[model samples]
Target: MFAAFDRPRISLRDAMAEALTKVPDVEIDPEGTFKYILVRVKDGDKQKDIVRGTKAAEYHNHIFDKVKPALEALGMECECLGGGKIEHNGKEKKIRVFGESTAFGKAEHSVSVEKLKTVFSNYEITWSDDKK
Candidate 1:
């Protein structure tokens, strides 16, 4: 049995995963927990996508605020950190993920590369399982 509540308890990572379905060009902590979300932000549309050049960051914030609860229902965490930009392809891509400096999963836990590829698509994304 569960207690009744008005709002759902949502962490930050879940939000980022959903955002990936749309914005799949950001870096996350190796683990699935919230630790790093480093990307530029925009209005989640093409205009902002080109102008501000941080669609991933924008969607990151959007998920934490709007859809985090939904993601929690599915079971995950979502977080937002400071702003940053990363070099990818021939341009600097904005970066934003989840979690603070305290999350253990940040550098400890790991995720399935195949799964991440499924989410982020295969363009410039590359990974080699260190554990293997």
Candidate 2:
């Protein structure tokens, strides 16, 4: 026997997961228990030079166009955190990922760190939550 209310919750989780599949190579936290998803670009040595100038802006725009909507579809308020530079290996590098923050709904959601890693594996996308 199960509570009738539990069905809708399960449905929503499934729906959210289904929506996420639209984004190529994306992974949502399976727990879906995050308050915010921190998206940051990794500034590794080789990528330092390429993710600069117009290229960076273009990448951000692409994220806005592609990633933002997918998150929004899952009921998240997406915030764009433009380009940023970080010091890695003692070198200044431009961050590539554009999505920085997101507010989650009152339900558990799934987050695929691996998928995010794969998609922006070169740039390094990270998520932040109250739990952290």
Candidate 3:
């Protein structure tokens, strides 16, 4: 497999930005703690929030901002990521973290969700259900 930075490639953040730009409704939680896993919002694209000046993209950026570093610190390979829709609201958001399935558990998901809740108001663990 190719290495993470085999060709004097850019820093992790730059690489992440480039990748983030490729998705439809994507954002990196600006206040998130996970470093490697580029989490994105998975829902609300079709909701009224879109027309109500709720930039789904910005929300995503906020999410990734908050979670990535901690996911990385938990021994989760940040660069190795796969994500999709889960849930969302003005305060709480949820997204599925996909990978080799062997890496995560429900408790890990709970901790991350709780952390996000702390930063975002009333951001309750609406659900922490990442089993795969």
- Name the runs in model 1 displaced over 4 angstroms: 1-67, 72-101, 107-112, 127-132
Give the per-residue lDDT of model 3 (tens digit) for 53-106: 112433333434445464445333232232222334433344332221222211
Clashes of each: 24, 14, 30
lDDT of 1 by residue, 36-80 (tens): 232223322321011011234443344345434543454434333
- In candidate 3, stretches whose alpha carbon ends up further than 4 angstroms from where it belongs are 1-86, 91-107, 130-132
How does each model score on TM-score? 0.25, 0.26, 0.26
TM-score of 3: 0.26
Q: Which regions of candidate 2 fall more than 4 Å away from where they truly are? A: 1-57, 85-132
Residues 48-93 of candidate 2: C-alpha lDDT, one tens digit per residue:
0012112222333443455556555645444433332221211221
Candidate 2 matches the true fold with a TM-score of 0.26
